[model samples]
Target: MNPIDRISRRINTLIQLPENKEVIFITDLRKEYRQDLKNFIFGETLAVKDGKIVIGKNLYKRWLQKIKTKGFDYDVKFI
Candidate 1:
């Protein structure tokens, strides 16, 4: 599967997003990245609103950390 698809699935498992919506919002992201760590997620996923990604939060922080460590291999540019 595509890397983005994997990320999407992971996010879905963490937080149930509306199936009808094509794009998730920054409002859906975790409080940390949504508020303070904004740059960490800027272009990692598709953006819909002002600067939100098409994803949500992860209480486990497992995939979130994986993304930060290995996201570059998936073409995610972190600054």
Candidate 2:
């Protein structure tokens, strides 16, 4: 699938993850979608672990909001 589709699929799986692990990397977040991340407003909803950027639940929600604002859609909300 395309990067955006993959991301949407991955985000859809966040609901199945443990409450403490509902996170994703900005890089892998888009993967092949090639979406810009330089201006992403992560604020304090993320954490860096083992050199990989990990975002938290709030950030995940914000990520969805950003995507939706851009006209993206999903059958369910994972975060």
Best by lDDT: 2
* lDDT of candidate 2 over 1-79, digit per residue (tens): 6778866667665433435454556555534322333245524555687788765556556655676577343333323
After superposition, candidate 1 runs with Cα above 4 Å error: 1-21, 41-79
Query: Whole-model lDDT, candidate 2?
Result: 0.52
lDDT (0-100) at residue 6 of candidate 2? 67
TM-score of each: 0.28, 0.44
lDDT accuracy of residue 9 in candidate 2: 69
Candidate 2, clashing residue pairs? none
Q: Tens-digit lDDT track for model 1 on 30-67?
A: 44334433555455544356654445444224345654
User: Number of clashes in every candidate structure?
Assistant: 0, 0
**Which pairs of residues collide in candidate 1?**
none
